[model samples]
Target: MADLYRRTVLVTRPEPGLSDTGFALERLGWEPCLAPMLRIYSVPMKQAGAVDRVIVTSGQSLEALRVALPPATPLTAVGARTAERARTLGFTAVDYAEGTANSLVGHLGRAGGRNSVLLATGRKLGVDLAAQLRMNGWRVTRRVVYRTEATESLAPAARSLLEQERVAAVLFYSAATARAFLDAFGEERGLLGSVRALALSPTIGRTLGAAPFREIAIAPRPEQQALLALLGPLPTSDTNTARREIAP
Candidate 1:
């Protein structure tokens, strides 16, 4: 069994997601230190008119929309989680593709008959989706429904773990989050020599740039479960030993 401290991981996703991933890590017997690198803010947007369909890339976009459109509006989501969120927000017609913008674009391409589509997304994001859909004969209207800003610094717990060199890995969910983390801690890249950098996608992994991590691994799929799988299973004996010491 690895030492308790050696099993620690730094979670760099923003809240809601941060808590969810941390809880999953705990269930897998890994210690997770919550460290949100980005702050998400809802950007109020006005829908000029109704559209045939709406596309959402993240749950944050749906939350920002505030269900302004009718509940029966046909919605296409980038992933199952976003589709679930759309349902929770009262949208009756919802469907999703594999967890990536490219997959969503392909899914729409295969669906035939192009129509006016509203792309609900974060500020300065989703350009590729809009462009691809337009190329495929869909009139796409892109709306910035939310904005993400980099936090000023790492959480105290995350900083302490890095300083002690106890963190085994750092999980990154988005390129924005990874960039935000770099903005906050780029000067200390050397500290990551013994830390593994785990990213949800290749794009996110590339965002880490030249950070001297012991290794950098990208998830096979752009989903939380795939990202967590990169950490492998924790030993049962270590799970019990760490649980007793770390339990609140």
Candidate 2:
């Protein structure tokens, strides 16, 4: 008897980077495919200010701000990964909260004072951290660090894999990615039924709406590493392997 998930696995994260997940799936003996639903690009902030704190929600935002902001400025990150990215860029006085926009805002409200806070974010962001901070009376500025765009085309092979029952799971990192994926699949909801959707957070799951076929799985934390950990099992046998194709 073999494990059930050796079936094909699709990594449908919005970001173009799927090497990490690709390698992980290979290690588990499952075929992996890359079908990124969204692409991220950054636009730098034009002005400078001596602020109380800066909030970074995504790793890309942290990378963008590192090149523009002073190294010594106080910073708070939405998660350890973002904080780690900050540290790599020489931001020493950094604070990290649980990896959620709300959690990050709450921590900033308690820790950040009247100093003008800069929020580096996407062009179309969910859960406005800046708005939340302003409501709490902290001055906030936003730097559009990135843009997420849906891919115009999905790989034919990946599309075929998605249409068939080859995909064992679908991974979503953001709400935007979820919406774009659903759109890409069109009427192929039947394939989704056989797949388990692994969302990075509860918020991502909510954006997916009521799909008749797929069972949604959420990670304890909003991180890729956590998603893998929560799924358990190393996926050894053929039954455990999934035919996976990623669309970016």
Candidate 3:
């Protein structure tokens, strides 16, 4: 029999690339489904609190704030794309770092003394940012301005993709997204064992906790393209990567 997955993939991107990735996967002879496990919603201004600066680590989070906040508030973002989103959303003075929490914090250090900083993010927010900022003499606040809840039901097409065993690989961009994907399958989560797991960061891979899979590739960076590139046809030589033991 021929290889089951010559080319089909299921992508669990947060909320950014549904069309483009679908096109790419189509070109690769794979059926791509936009099983957006997490949904992004703007934090209503009525519920927002006072803050001097807003820190955005993801473009989606930045976009959510854009819809909720007015212009002129100083915005600090994680990457170029996030900065661009902020600018487009009416924040003229946008400061963005090299695209990670540590890098963004480092960039903030150079600017100095913002007094109060508010982090707008989803539910699963537990990074070492607030403590670091507090130690540095800045009052930091975490306001779950928005949330990305896992879809209760996968799209019919996505279910077919998973149930048919046509999925060759699954890409996880964030630890939260990975959890959402795992939850989407519920009790049948083991079905995912047949698909290779790809993660954008080691943080995401570690979240897998040894899920039954032969290969789990971690992208060096958080870029979508980089993550996808790592997923490109697994090498056809002596396999050096070890199998991940899925924890129950």
Best by TM-score: 1
Looking at model 1, report the run of 10 residues with the lowest lDDT sum. 239-248
Stretches off by above 4 angstroms in model 3 are 23-31, 46-52, 67-70, 124-127, 233-248
Q: How should the candidates be ordered by lDDT, best one leading? A: 1, 2, 3
| Per-residue alpha-carbon lDDT of candidate 1 for residues 1-248, written as tens digits (9 for 90 to 100) | 33345778888887646777778888888887777788888888776487888898988888766557778888999998778877887889999999999998889883356488999998889998889888988888899998988887777767777888778899999999888887887577788887889999999989886688888999999988988999875534445323211111
Residue 241 accuracy (lDDT) in model 3: 30
- Pairs clashing in candidate 3? 210-245, 210-246, 211-246
Candidate 3: Cα lDDT at 95: 83
lDDT measured at residue 222 in model 3 versus the true structure, 0 to 100: 70
Task: Tell me which of candidates 2 and 3 scores higher on lDDT.
Answer: 2
What C-alpha lDDT do the candidate models reach, one value each?
0.81, 0.72, 0.68
Per-residue lDDT of model 2, residues 1-248, tens digit only:
22343366677764423666777776767677878777877777667567777888887686678788889988988888778778988998998989898887777664344658888788867346777877888777777877778876667877786666656677777787788878776776555666778889988888765575457888987776888665565455434444444435
Question: lDDT of model 2 at residue 28?
Answer: 63
Find the number of clashing residue pairs for candidate 3: 3
Candidate 2 vs candidate 3: the TM-score winner is: 2
Q: Decide which is better by lDDT, 1 or 2.
A: 1
The alpha-carbon deviation from the true structure for residue 81 of candidate 2, after best TM-score superposition, in angstroms, is 1.3
